[model samples]
Target: MEHRQSFWENLVVVAIALVLIQTFLDDFAVVAGWAWAPREVLLYAGLALDVFFSVEFLTRLYFSFIRRRTGIYFWHERGWIDLLASLPLVLLSSGPAALALWSGSTIALGRASLLNVLKVVKAIRIARVLRLLRLLKVFARIRNTDSTMAQRHVAKVATLSVTVLIATVMLLGIAFSVFDVPSLETAYQSRITTLLAAVEGDLDRGAPIDAGELAARESSLLAVQREGRTLFSRFDSDYYARQVGPNDYGFAERGDFRLFFDLRPVNRDQSRNNLIYFAIIVVTIGALLFAYSPHFALTVTDPLHVMTRGITEANYSLEVKVPRLYRDDEVFELARAYNEHYLPMKDRRSAASADGFDLSMDDVQGLLDD
Candidate 1:
């Protein structure tokens, strides 16, 4: 039988894909100049997409399950993801708190659950979203598996790896925060209280306050609050010079004292480089692996996303993968070197764009020769 692709199914995939992209790839600054109108509206589109997917997934699942036998074959691999991406939203109105709890737990798992929701996130161009493609591939493989054992094992590994990784990261963050937050919090609270008390006696206190005491009091409070504000909030020089200032939250964004913040290896630029690198790794391995073909349809890589417009490397990718997929030679060498330069090609191409993309001409020529 010819396979029929459902409209809802396509949207199901897109919805999750969008979520992944938005969560991950950031420009480090607001994306101001994109063609999108009233940009915040686009964010609302996400919520709408989520709602549509939820309804579609449920209606399909409900009726399909009633017709058990055919539904087993017709619905096939993605039922679980559809269910997962769908249910949480439905639970929202009925049980908003439950939904919040669910989201919290899922986010705590990091890439694991994110990878699944990301499959539905749509064409979000953000780079971080591409990382979840690896997770989606695993889901696809298990879903396409012919036998119970194959699907079961794939399921097991995906679950085990995701659960373990998320649990580890979550616990570590919690433990570190728990262990380290107190000193900073204590410093913040103590400083603020001291400053507040002194200010209150002079200013916030009842009517007959002395004007001179107000100046001295203000000065003292400014100094104290300045210290508090600088630690957790934005730097305030005058406030620091004075005593009481701001009640601000942290000594430094709450996590500053953690070892991860203290000893984190990647600088901001390097962090961007790592994400670009990770995107390459996940997207490459996810698609290239003939292993994942069954469950989810692999999104073909766009050569355009691989290269910056002026970069010599961008021109090279156009030559290799453009018409014919995969090539070798001087152009091929260039493409290979492109991947080889900083990190593997596997890590670079994470997200897709609607603009038409083509492979390099030389690679196309090589393919025709073969």
Candidate 2:
């Protein structure tokens, strides 16, 4: 049972770390226009992790009730934070259900406005920031464990670095959303208008321009083009001269003047969507670092320091017991070994002193005589 519990705990830790990393990469994919397949896979993996976390949380609560430790568990563990952290996943999964119900029902202010409001409410997924509280809980648990002052300081520094990195990423993402998107949108619109005017001028002059030439010209335009929808010029031999189409079209025949503007919303929405993912990614990373730093310090740094201190004090004829670690791991085993050796050596030293065996001169003179 103990081993099984340990396995689950380790699995949870690994899952949390993986999810944090996956979320960050998923955000990068959104901003970089990478393929969606890997991002979708990560999303499903995150959902699976969320399910595991939810089950773990409920299992803890159930055991707490059964053991009559509800008060102590809630007070010390702050189990409420776990519930808050899990809420985003639950709410996100239920969004479609809520939307479907809203769609089927009638609202006094019209379904369009109500649907918009519901869509905004879906942003509640941002509440995933509450997951950071779980990190704080982990930090607290680590601090309460047997660890040296040096280890605690190292953990603090690591946690601070992670926090700063997260803040920097969020700021950079916000700047991209606020400035870069608008500037790009403006440039794209300008390009579209320029192309339209050039085609129009050619049509006015009755220039014999083929549809293929126009398409080739468009292909030569800048690469940072807006995605989703685009505006272009088309030519149709049967249509009136200089006629603009409402939708995108293929190249036109020679002397057919057709312009089509792909009308879609600006890139602001795309940027905002990217920013949302960025926030989620940053928060998850920060939380994971905060939670893991202390564990790392205790496991890797604390035991060595304790052993060093014990040896140093022993040189001064002062017996120093190695501090016992709360974790029953390799570090604890090392501490136990040190104590085992120290106790026997200490007893031998005491026995020698009680027998009045002065090692300075008398013992040396006796050995020489023999």
Candidate 3:
């Protein structure tokens, strides 16, 4: 049971880390038009990870209840953060896509307000950063080792870096969306114009016009209408009605023939600039993180960890070995104090115990030698 628990706990840590990385890559997929991991892959992966986190939250809740530590779990252990990061995120991230698929149509620019609302909601996926805070819970579970504090501080620094990266990605995504929407709309209008011209030519020649054939050839057609009547519809009656609403469909009129086209196909191709921006952001953020990690550990966490271990140990004589490259900074002063002032005072107190009480191994050995 203990080993199984250990395994799952470790798995939770890994999942937390993976999801954070995946969420960042997802921004690249969605906003930057990164083909390496497409939007579909990231969406499904995010859903799967969200499920895993939900299960983890429930399991932790159950165990905490059984142990009669519900308050500790929810409040102190940040079970709320787990729940916050899990279910709401799934709905926010995947909900719009699911709705789009169900309706068999993309929300048109006519519903720009609703589209903007969805964009803001989608931006809430940044809450996935909350998962980083849960890493602190894992740190609390870790055994008291010399490296544990160092590991925790490193995790904190990493979490902060990732949070900043995510924020930058969100801002960039918003900027890209502005340009991308117009580009997609232009593409849709161009396709509709070309098809309208072809249909007009066919009408002039009195060629048999088959909306089904045209739609089949055109992957983006949700439905097609002639003379403002439902000539051919790919949607069910209800969805078709929804598509014909004033703002939902685009129309082109020539003499006696009126043609209406569903504009949802515009989403199939992203703007070229989106792809360029995606590459630049991903490479730059990745390079920055790679360069930052070692320097952060060496200068900050390593020294703090050494001081922590020295201070916590039972031995009064333990000395902090300041690294050769270490500056005469706060950590250096801490080490100097530990080795000189603190250790000497502690040793004097220990030596004053003439009855040889509470003597450590070094003290006993020294006494034996004398």
Candidate 4:
């Protein structure tokens, strides 16, 4: 049995190492929040990996509880260690970086309170490993090919999951679509300002913005103003009573920051709608679609996003790489006019071929005949 003990010890070591490494990723917060040198995308990537380890730890704990029930189980030293080891992984789950992207403070607080019982996705790559190990270990113990308490527990969890998910989505939809936004003294600034500057550089290098730049900026700024109240006003209840707000939260009735800055919003309605619906629908439909695949045909929305781009853009050969997708002579005139007259657009817009615009193979012969 020393060999059996050896395997679990080794597995625990791996889990412990992963969880410890995951906890340190909050160190990247300094980079993500930087004004000029921010690496938000990479920071988020690290957070995602941390989330994976957190989920793995929780799943193991859930199975452990099911395995230990007898009075002796309570007094078992190894069992005690097995149950308590999951605690460190749990505490690391809520480091600052993970909470930054959380739904408003209200929802975030609620989720934090409930994390003690939470489980991660059952089919993620890590979960598959746990399942495989269990299968191999239990193969000799199968009882006449029927009911186990673990299977029952899984069913109960599934039913509860569906109910909770639907309710959560409903609340977020209302919050996102209908609730009025208040102004916020933001805890974290956005990286969008940096992104917009980069986009402007692309535009300036490509075409004169005197007329065009003013236009895009004007539209984008207006979006910011209109949505400012709706965007920044999230709050915590405890914070409402105190001067700065409690535990860095507030759920104020109204608030905005457009008053303090030379601000503009980008397609505010569309951005908000996408932020709310796209996130929810993509997650909800994705989960439901995968879950129901055993019972029905399902197509995920993100995979179908191609048909959603503008038809004008669809025809603009300059916009996409598909040689046959667009025959836009007009947009070619537009791209060339925009490019040759300017510093020349960099990246995809600059590298796009003018020949592809209207010069089909047939058009070359027609021009020769002419």
Candidate 5:
């Protein structure tokens, strides 16, 4: 039973590692500006992992109750964090599946707003990045089995890594919200109005008969042109041109003007994507460091667990040997030395008892008298 539990725990570790790798790939998709096809692959891969984790969580929960360890399961087992991390992905992944089903219905096919719904589904899918926090909890659990010294060292390093990651994310989020959002929104709005006027041919209105009218018209046209150029410069020239359909004005600028007016959301999405990339790199490195550093500690502590168990059992006249570890480290050497001294002493005592050689002063006096 214990072996089976260990097997599952090891499998869970591997699953978590794969999930983190998928997350990193998703982050790369954002950073490298991957199109929908590649991004969707990563998204589906993440959703599969989320399903696996959800099942693992349920299995553990059921076992916790069956074993009558609800308190330890809830608090010490970190069941809450597991649920938080898995539920979001499950909910987000279901959106697209639900949309696919709805798309085949007559009412859905008739709706012009389905494209907007699809966009919302994509946005929700991106939010699965929040599940990366579960990796930190996994790291904590892995190192918790180490000796006190090892635990202290691992705790310090893990804390530092988490702190740096959180600080980086917070700083980027605050800077983007405070500075970039307002400026980008203002620029976007100004550019939209200019584009709309240009597309309507309002800027081509004839100069007035009066000199003041001619001057004002010329200045206004120049201002509108400048703003148009500024907005155009925000995008790659070729890409902007390609996105501008016959009826559309430029990148993100439509003839209808309704969709073009609300550019703030687009800017916010881009800013969010940037932060997600930053978080992926930062958290991946931290998790890698925290996850692998405990091997050295585990080596020593695993042997110690065996040695302590052997010693405890030896007290009840049961001979026990500390299982020899395969490593040639200090702990291995100590185990060797302990066995070498202990086994010989144990053998001598057993031999003496079998031969009735009791070292008593009364027996020695009787022998001397004889």
Candidate 6:
């Protein structure tokens, strides 16, 4: 049967096109450093796509069962692709980052292991890129072409996409970490300086130093030590200037007494910055993958699909029409050759068969070669 497009199918294609547009806009907002509110709205729109696709998959399964082709659809017809792409990717990607933000947890010494586990969880957002495979299935349906060929091409493209994405994310992750070091160090120094001046001012006024009162006044101070002994400590064990790194310690000395502050608020700020950076990466890469996937169909798979289908269905003549937009391409050239040469030769052989003409073996070979 000749390929034909239906109105409802065309409507679905339009919807997919709009979804791709939304994905691009979301990425643009992230790259442009727009406010979070609009970016978030764009992100929630993805949930609707997830729900839409889930329903579409269910509908496909229903038809596959009616046609007794469930196995064929599940494997050969790319039903697995549909199932994977239909997942609630927006929620899956956002949930970990949201938890990181809401928990207000830090990668301080005691919590480092827990934060590492959460970072691993945040990596699940990378799977969101798999949603782009739906573009291949849409092209297959729109063009009435074989899904397997498009699936093969899409797999190759997807591998390249994932490689580039992972590399980009790793480089950015490293960049954020390195750049954060200086800012964190400066913040710690400023906080320490301010607290030291406050304590010294109190001492100059002939006030007795009270470690407990100082710690209560300073939120960043987890503990305060004096004269090589614990004066006041928030945790069970005393955290001294020597026990932790220089960035997590500040000290003051006055003649015979030495005072130490257990400084770790800078570490908390670093963890929050890392979470924000991770969220930005996920949004940008997901948008880019969705925006570019359709171009693969237009330039590569769609034309190949039309040419291969035309050739396969050429029993008497070429019935599938080559898309006019591909006129300058090799696929169009193949279609032209099939129409101008192969069909005429086929017609001649058919006439010979009807007329009882005993053609030579060479003539039969020539006809087959055409």
Q: Pick the TM-score winner.
A: 3
Root-mean-square deviation (CA) per prediction: 19.3, 14.3, 9.4, 29.8, 12.7, 14.0
Each prediction's TM-score versus the true structure? 0.35, 0.42, 0.49, 0.22, 0.46, 0.40
Which scores better on lDDT, 3 or 4? 3
Q: Which candidate is the best by lDDT?
A: 3
- For model 4 the local lDDT of residue 321 reads 22
Worst 10 residues of 5 by lDDT: 244-253
List, residue by residue over 203-250, the lDDT tens digit for candidate 5.
246421232332243221211123233321223556434432211121
Off by over 4 Å in 4: 1-8, 27-73, 76-78, 85-370
Ranking of candidates on TM-score, top first = 3, 5, 2, 6, 1, 4
**What is candidate 6's local distance difference test score?**
0.54
Decoy 6 TM-score against native: 0.40
Q: Tell me the tens digit of each residue's lDDT in model 4 across 1-370.
A: 9997778656645544443333222222321222212333433444554455445445555555677643344332223323332333233323342454453232121213222111121011111111111111121122221333333333334334433443454455335323322212110112223324444565557742232333344332211212333222223334333322111221111112221111112112222432343334334433433454322211222111222232223233223222233225443344334444432343344367532244566868877898
lDDT of 6 at 36: 48
- Each prediction's Cα lDDT score? 0.38, 0.48, 0.57, 0.32, 0.51, 0.54
Question: Candidate 3, residues 141-162: lDDT per residue as tens digits?
Answer: 5433345445455445544554
Candidate 6 per-residue C-alpha lDDT over 1-370 given as tens digits, one digit per residue, 9 for 90 to 100:
1233366566567767766556456445544544446655655576666667777788889989999999999987678777766754544643433443347442232112422332333344334444554554444443322455544555445444544554565555545444544555455555655666677787688778788877777666665656577777766643332234333344455533455555444434443443454344445444434454455555566655655654444343443355678666776576667667766776676677653334557878977888
Task: Provide the lowest-lDDT 10-residue window in model 3.
Answer: 264-273
User: What's the C-alpha lDDT at position 147 in model 1?
Assistant: 46
Clashes in each model (backbone N, CA, C under 3 Å)?
Answer: 49, 2, 0, 16, 0, 0
Q: lDDT, candidate 1, residue 286?
A: 49
- Point out where model 1 deviates above 4 Å: 1-5, 25-39, 68-155, 167-203, 206-370
Better of 4 and 5 by lDDT: 5
When sorted by lDDT, best at the front, the candidate numbers are 3, 6, 5, 2, 1, 4
State which candidate, 4 or 6, has the greater lDDT.
6
Tell me which of candidates 1 and 6 scores higher on TM-score. Answer: 6
